[model samples]
Target: MACRRLGGVPWLFLILAWLPALCAAQTRAPYIPASPDVVLQQVPPTTDPRVRRFEQLRLDLQRHPHDAKRAVTLAQAYVDYARSTGDARFLGRAMAVIDPWMRRPLPPIPVALVHATVQQSRHFFKASRQELTTILAREPNNAQAWLTLATVAMVQGDMDEANRACVKLANTGGDFMGMICTASLRMLTGRAPQAYALLGLVEDPGPKAPPEIRAWIEGLMADTAMRLDRAALAEQHFKQALQWTPGDNFLLADYADFLLDEQRPRDVLALLQGDSASDTSFLRQVYAETALGLPQAKADAAAMAARFAAMDARGSHVFQREQAGFALHVQHDAPRALALAQQNWTVQRAPQDVRIYLEAALAADQPAAAQPALDFVQRTHLSDPSIDRLVARLRSDAMAQAAPRAKP
Candidate 1:
């Protein structure tokens, strides 16, 4: 589920490392523990054991704030929660938990990993890469460090570095993780068919693999299929992923985009209903509402505007792509959307990024401004039906504009 807009790899292995025992234990009725306000989603005591463990960990860390080991453990748990919930605030909480070791010349491996995770979540790729490099220099056989480095490199569009890190992972880590790492990069680099076929070779680990990992692989397959114009296969893979990890924000957002592209706004609404806690989900809901011309669209657009304004006021520019889409589709400000999309392109060149840039450029009647996107398509040899249609339309419009006026 590590789509371009979502940022970074899925980090399923990190979550797998901390999964609690699944056995049902005999105990009294569950009660809420007095924990910090950092918990974003409230899990009733009687339900998910993961939530119970998270609550206990929070309370334990609060009691022994000076204990480095407990702090690292809690921070790691918070990072896992952030990944599962898509709540960026949990990343901030993870940073707070590890604040004590932030300035150390060489923090513990656990703390360093948490720090890098938080940095990457916040879009600080360079900082995260630096930390991971330092960790790997010290522990050359660190599988997690290699995987993280590959993820950071992929996000930054440095495929060469990502390939190198994947090779390192394959040498140190098992083939399963390494294959996933390499296949994801291949999918982005115009080898969708090969990536999909290679990924199909991954043997099902059954209980050995976490559900999240399986869901992530299925999601990637769905994306590859979509790029290949295999709509039926893509939808099937998406369905399989949702079955594995129901209500995952990343999966929900990605499927909503697919529905939007298919002109199924109602399905998008149904999928994202009552799921607006994360910014990604909220953006998708806004898009769906706008497409349906729902009464809530106005309010949702205004709310998103205000949220972006607040982020701008705080000097946070990590959401330029989402903001640009809102501007183009919701606010109807083509120029502003083009500007934001251009700014976003300078940071990430994923296919979605190119699409938005092309969209804004076309909407604003600035075909020349879309050269970067067209160049990207040519350079990467990316093939997507939607992008192909857009390119054709852009050419048609340019020709229509350039036609001579014979009779004045």
Candidate 2:
């Protein structure tokens, strides 16, 4: 699904109907910039069609030794895969691939790009800044680098920086990067029209775009549609994305959540593989565990536990996912879940995570938990039948509790 050249990597984005591009609201702490500029050189191979392909590049690296350029290419591929896939491990793998020669320099354009991406992925704002600036210092027109810089800025909640960087990159290509970034700022900043306009660039999925690229677009389209309150369209795009990337864990999780919202848990069990090892698979683990009467409940729970526990929540997607899991499993605290949902409800997961958590909290008789979520829904001006239903339930429950009763 991705084309990662020998030096530069590709990001893998799933079909978009899942949630906010920001993924999750991180709680740990601020992302620290790399203390020092980590310069990497050693260009990867510029030839070989197989080397140019992601699968081939990965295999080529595994088949050989310190091929710096190929390593970078392979690493970048992983980064791109991680980005589009919404999987942090792929990013970790990208970092791991470059860990050995990170002390050295001179890989290739693509390889260096991958490193810059890694910094961005880690939310190592400082490092991302340094690497990006340095890269642009050399290749000023490297639109991808500019996009990476902008994404890092966006994650930091630096709207100005994100705008500036995204604007610069916006014209770099008529491709997905420019359109997606421009639309991203628009959506997050409450410019649905602007965002939708940008999305319109990719009116239909391209046949030539690789699988990963296709998946990313699908996910993006779904996200935009959901924001516009197009549930059927969102589900449609999600299904398409899932079809394209069957092995994609992120897509699976998103789909599972969608299923949950649709009250179709019976389907979740078939898609998600439940096992102790599935722990690192965050969203999928959640899907497998939540679907009651799952064929292999115990195994699914174990997998969910292992995967969830092993996850590194630095990435926004992973962090938010883990938070949701905590609300679902550890806390069973609908209030906490509702809090987490509303925290990001404005961003994405519109009627799903936000509403589901709020509803669950109310259904669980946690009126306090439902309060903040209600305020959030009204403030955002989000009007959905589901939200209305849940709101009514919460209000009714609160009223019942408040009513005076005859002495029993």
Candidate 3:
């Protein structure tokens, strides 16, 4: 299960990678086998086989420091562990272990594929593309490699490559979850209709699809629907997905997004009650933002503040969530909130965080704080209508307010 989570954590497929020289670097270092320390989480219950394999690899590597075979095997196990658990640090460790051997003389093709999965997590599109190219050159019929290439190509905004890869993989057999992947990608790229059509072919209504495949398809479908301005569809699909996979932290987060968008901030708070404190920054933001409309919002801020503080103190979570909080609370002597939010943003560049900080600065009357975010949004060219409309309204209203207080 850890391996499966690692295999599928959002955006993780973009980061880590393997190469031949990286392995060489490890080989020369104090005779130390690349046993990169793998941090793990026990939650969500990883499958026992994945856990057993991860432990076996760790022990094997402990014994044979120089055996590339064992090290590569161990790294793949770690990838599996990380995927199953949805924790990234294990994959990071896996990369450190495999780095010395990437590219200068690529690891075995399968091992290289594992390496590519890590790279994909980091959004290193170019490297990911290279990984697929190399793998396909060696074995064009490798379905997983092709699907991955398609996925990464979509990440890099290379829709044509993605389409080609998907077209090729569509014919390949096995529980290929290509529809989910392709449809979601298409939806994000502003082809919601195509996404929906592709989604129609997914095995969601069937009794035979495995839970993992079902969850993947359902989550993507819900998200695509939400982004395409189909909030009701999003809500329905999200609830259905949840029914199929209860206690999914990711699904809860999506629900929060939907609630906030629909102006039901209190619902967001209630829905996220069971989520881990660190995981609810965005939802917490919905609370903070919606608080202005509530008579007793300040009362809730304390708990939210505590949650942020605990997360800040915990130090394992990323910077984006923290940045969002700062953008929310900095207006009223909330320096700690601002700092924490900024801290998280600095550690990682999340577009959502950028949006929050932009809005926060605007609300706080800190134009300087907003400039960079403004630039980032413009550069990224995200045409989020709600945000654009809000910004436009703010400007228009500001201009109107400034025009005449003359008679009064």
Question: How high is each candidate's TM-score?
Answer: 0.83, 0.62, 0.59
| Candidate 2 per-residue lDDT over residues 173-243, each given as its tens digit | 44567778878766555565667677777746567777776776687667666666677988888888867
lDDT of 3 at 115: 76
CA displacement after TM-score superposition, residue 335 of candidate 3 (Å): 14
What ranges in model 1 sit over 4 Å off?
1-48, 62-67, 392-408
Candidate 1 worst ten-residue window by lDDT: 1-10
Q: Give, for candidate 2, the lowest lDDT window spanning 10 residues.
A: 1-10
TM-score computed on alpha carbons, candidate 1: 0.83
lDDT pick, better of 1 and 3: 1
| Candidate 2 lDDT score at position 10 | 25
**Candidate 3 wrongly placed segments (more than 4 Å):** 1-86, 96-104, 123-126, 171-178, 203-206, 265-270, 274-408
User: Model 1's lDDT to the true fold?
Assistant: 0.79
The 10 consecutive residues of candidate 3 with the worst lDDT sum are: 1-10
Clashes counted in candidate 1 amount to 0
- Better lDDT candidate (1, 2): 1
Q: Per-residue lDDT tens digits of candidate 3, residues 202-262?
A: 7454887766567667777776676567888878888777777655555666676667668
| lDDT winner | 1
